[model samples]
Target chain A: MERKVCAHIQCRLGPMRLGWHGTIQTVADVIKMLFKEVYAPSGADKLMFYLAPLIVLIAPFIVCALIPFGRNLVVADVSMGIPLIIAVNGFGVLGILLGGWSSNNKYSLLGALRSGAQMISYEISFTMILLFVVMISGSTNLMSITLGQEGTILDWWIFKIPVLGIVAFILFFISSTAEMNRAPFDIAEAEQELTGGYHTEYNGTPFAMFYLAEYIALVTNSALATTCFLGGFLPPCIGVAFVDNYLNMVPGVVWFFAKVYFMIWCYMMVRWTFVRPRVDQLMDFEWKFLLPVNLVLLATGAAYIVIWG
Target chain B: MSEYIILSIFLFLGAFIAAAATVTGLLLGYRTKNTANKMAPYECGMETIGNARIQFKVGYYLFALLFLVFDIEALFLFPVMMNFREIMAGHTPLSPMIVLIDLAIFIVILVSGLAYAWKKGILKWE
Candidate 1:
């Protein structure tokens, strides 16, 4: 009885202590510890070490600005949306390369080199899939693509083009995973091999930046996928009167995020479920399997467009 | 114009967030002088060894070269893709058959090159 009373008092006091001052103090302590880890004097080049993480963190945010969350709700509706996204994302590879090289560590350098090669190989298929989408959608603007699929579930690119659409969606999904440096394609930072890959020497806020960049890229890629293939912000309605009427009541923005998070959930599942592929297997898989399939898919998309139109 | 302005603002905001995090860490974190051993490259807790940087296989460079070729070829298809609707609508002088045949030829050449690389064992990692 006495122990139970003491426990009750302790739980109540714990909540009171954690309300305000406790929270602030904890945050301050964390900041101090983070700074200590980050500011430790190291032999690596200071400029590249710092700059690379910053660039990687920021690049994804900038790329995401061009993505349309809802109609006219985009931060920037650029004409060259697809190309711009590709260009900005390409900068992320440079940042990784620089971070690895500047660390003056062998493991970091190898990790960086692997990242460069992996990104370049996957980018070929990535671009081809985007081109295929552009061919079918008839515009490079993301907004237009979203609008094109505004009708119903059947109008979405993933279903509209039959076999080619599904193939492109799968190809895009895989390549985007590679582009974001997520597993099983994440050979660059395979911990068993490269000891944290490009960010081996990173700690503190610099490491935080790399972490931030990755999650942001995941969210942005999901949004890109939602926009390109899954009928961005379009609720499911198969030309039914009641369902269409009911679904349209919910805001497009909500639909947009719901779909985006669902895709993000899928990515999380994929990351956890798969083991990392060997580096040679990764290259061969891309060069032999993904590359050829994407080439054929692109051609099929083009032929379909010409023959049908 | 406004769109570019928004994009610039977004970029600036990202940079600002990154700088703030780093600065906060720098200001709050403790600083210590580096010792020779402390500054040395990490090697799984072993003593100093030879340089970590060594020549890698030529296969990586070869893949990079091939990537450049294929990527550029893919880019060339962009204009044709974007204008596909126009060609189909009979708005342009180009015929659908010519466009289809042209893309087919380009893809055929690209695939053949891939075949050559695969046959040469350049794609093999081992």
Candidate 2:
């Protein structure tokens, strides 16, 4: 879907050969991946190499359990939703680190090192922004956070607090994009530099695991953004009674997924328009620029509530 | 809690699905004749050089250290941020001034350390 979106954005057809405007291309790719030869280099640490993809694949799976899909559709509506998500997502980084170390390749090592630093640094601001949301919502539970954005669309977290909320939301979008290792912040798998990075040695199913995990993380992050900044599962009604009633006719789950996919589409749009930064420049941007801004934003939120509330 | 139980199930299920997929691929995947060249580590189409375990820059280690310190602080700050409004509204037993002063001190110390690190050029890649 991302590829198709990118292709159409560039006024080109993608996957014309596959069924239904290449909708089945992903299935074909998966089948091809499963049948491909799984190769392990003689120098590779076989145990770690095999374990890495599994660990990477597990992070998003666990997060899925924590996120509230709709009012009552969540798998696990844990109280520590945001914090646990941040912590669980770190496991993916561990998997990449192990995968790179076990591969025993210079490019892989460098890529892994870059990724570790990049992600760890950006995560500070990411959580800070999440903390900002928790402050506004007054609860750590994901469902509560979503419910706090009740009423009109303007009641959403992004618009609830005037300048602070949107600033934090934009910061959240930027850092979350970086957190997921999306393009523009994808120094980890800058193929031009690292030739597939941490998964450099992986082929066949293991490579597919990494590939699938990236997409899953992408969706998971977008879903999180939808839940946090946008009004999750809440229709975009502007306080008109009949209109709101009509909008509510559609299920909340539909609104939830629609918002999630819209976020994903925005990601795809931004991804295709890229200007990759030097590894050093990228690090400086996060550590120096993003972190301080996030801190100030949090302080502003605190002031906003104390003064206005 | 039952949530923890469900979470554990999720973890095991994820790992199991990943393992099952890999096993299925191994079972169905065709083997090719192993060549020595095919088994060597990639080095951008060049021959493998010195061990990949060669010395790396300390900048990454420095960043990791800084991250470890800050990340824990952020975690500690979460609970405080969540209930800040209620506390300010005198819902909690503790006075609002104490909480305010504490957060101010916390952020001040955090920012100063960041400034110190910045001045020392620890964040610089070189």
Candidate 3:
């Protein structure tokens, strides 16, 4: 009788059966594949190989902890928040380099080397753009920077500095996209050329670690951009009295997540829209174009702050 | 500090989550006996060739070196940037003009190095 009832229910819910049962089976298969030893590292330096995924897994979360979700809702409100973020993110490159080198595959090695070069190169412009924000806001703390633009949308850094603000935001956006190794700047993991790049040999749960790290990094980068450029957690106060009051009633965290998600959506669009550039062209774009332009913008931003203040 | 404690806790949580996933995969997944071909580094289904760690061009190394010099320079400029408002407010020892000139000079030197690299064709991709 129980078997007959089970068969009847299964037949009745046939379309819905795949939804839950299929998902569980897929999860089980993935778990089995993850545990199967595909390529075991056997050498004196085997310990370092294991450290790679662990670092990649945890570093982004550490960076995420420093980001302020709301006015006073940060996990760690360090004084040197921006610099701390830049410094901790540098460890992500270490994991990629180690994973690639230890994989004992040619494609992985090439991908790892490219990743190192790409990240270090873009990080210069990335930091320079942050410096412009620091100079304008006059504080290394992200909370103060966000608070500096609290009153109105016009007060935000993107609008506050006129042309320089917009230019800096664009430059920061580009460099950060490259820094995160998304789409156009993802020569490190170019599928046609370098296979899977640094994590080519990775599989199972270890591969998932790198994959999760990349998404987490993407979220952190977009959130930082939102906090630094857009007014962090500030609602659009259009100066209309009732509308402003209504918008303000929504919690700051909601506003923060809304803006961050919008930025993430923009990033996803860019990733899907553009084709990856050649490695040399990628380097050329940074050195010949971005670096020089950013330098000029940095000086201009400094002058703007000094002359206007 | 309490802030550092929070950061450490967050870090620990991230690690714990990652470890749990990996351990669960290991414990629940079926283990198959390793074979020579199955364990080899993948090369598009071809037999493994010579080691992948062969020497490439030195141009990449040169670019990284240039990046290092400028990155350090940017770090040194952070203090000047952070203090711009204070200098302008007349709270600092240095005047705005003096600070601006100091920054201009530092930038000029860095720019000249970049120019040198360009002139030497080190920045050239082809």
Candidate 4:
């Protein structure tokens, strides 16, 4: 799907051979990966090298449970749902750091360090944006958040909070993209510079684990953005009777996935569009700029709630 | 709550699946390549240098320091923000002014710390 989007945007054939436009390319890649040599470096720290992939792979899946896919489709509607999701995903960086360190390879270690700083800095902004949503929604419960935006389209958090809502949404998008280490922030795995970065020494299933975790994190983060801002599973009602009724006829799960896939498409588009920033530039943008803006947004969000309420 | 149980189970399931896939790959993967290059660390196509464990710069550790401070601050602010609406509406015995003023002071202090880091060039990369 990501390749297909890249092809569409760039005017080229993406995956024409394997399945319909290379739809099953991923399946073929997995099979090849499974049969490939699972090599372990002689100089590597055996324990950590083996453990890092598991840690990285599990973090995203655990967070997936907290996302409310539909009205009642959530796996674990924990009380601390929002904060917990961000915190759990934080663990992925640990795996990356460990993977790089244990690989006993220069490129992997450097890649890990770069990604660690990028992810941690962006995470502060990411959490602040989610806190912005929680401030508006009044509770961290994922269900309440989804149900709170029950009215027309304007009632959604993105439109409901005026200027700050849209601003927070965009900030959330950027920070989450960075946190996931996708294309623009993908210097960790920069093909030319790092030569596969942290996973340089990994092969077979372990490497596949990192690859799968990346996409899983993508879906989890997109679902989070959708649930927090776009109104999870809530049909886009334009305040008219006929249209609203017809829209409601479609299941909330369908709408939920539609929004998620759309957010994923948006991610892919941004990935293919921009060039990655230098490491110093990336850090400066976060600490000097994004963090301060987010802090101010938090202050304004508090003020907005006090006055508007 | 049952929710917590389900979450734990989900976590274990994820771990199990990852472990299972890895084991499956080990069982079925190629074993013929026993060359010294296969066991060596990949530093592009060239031979690797001395060791991968060189001393990193202090800038990396400084971010960790700042993160720890802000992350701990978040742990405190979260509970207050979560119930800020209730506190303002007189649901609690405490006055709303006390809460707002406290939050203002906290954030002001945090931002000041950040500014000090910025101006001192602690944020600058070597």
Q: What share of the true interface contacts does each candidate keep?
A: 0.66, 0.74, 0.61, 0.68
Please provide, for model 2 over A1-309, each residue's C-alpha lDDT reduced to its tens digit, 9 standing for 90 to 100. 988988998999978789877879999999998998887887889999899989998999988888788889889888999899989988888998999999989888888888888888898888889888999889888999998889998999999898787888789889988888889889999999889878788899989998899999989998999999899888888999989999989999999999999999988888999878889899989988999899889888999888887
Span of ten consecutive residues with least summed lDDT in model 1 chain A: A1-10
List, for all models, the DockQ compared with the true complex.
0.62, 0.81, 0.58, 0.78
* Candidate with better DockQ, 1 vs 2: 2
- Candidate 2 off by > 4 Å: none
TM-score of each: 0.89, 0.98, 0.90, 0.98
Residue B48, model 3: lDDT of 80
Off by over 4 Å in 3: A1-45
lDDT of 1 by residue, B9-85 (tens): 88888878888888888877666666677777777778657665577878779988998888778668778888897
Per-residue lDDT of A185 in model 2: 89
Docking class of 4: medium
Can you list the residue pairs that collide in candidate 2? none
| Model 4, span A189-274: residue lDDT tens | 88889988889889999999998999999999999899999998999999999999999999999999999999999999999999
How many residue pairs collide in each prediction? 1, 0, 0, 0
A122: Cα error in model 2, Å? 0.8
lDDT score for residue A278 of model 2? 89
Considering chain A alone, report the TM-score of candidate 1 relative to the true chain A.
0.88
Over the stretch A89-140, how does candidate 3's per-residue lDDT look in tens digits? 7778888889888887888888988998899889989999998999899888
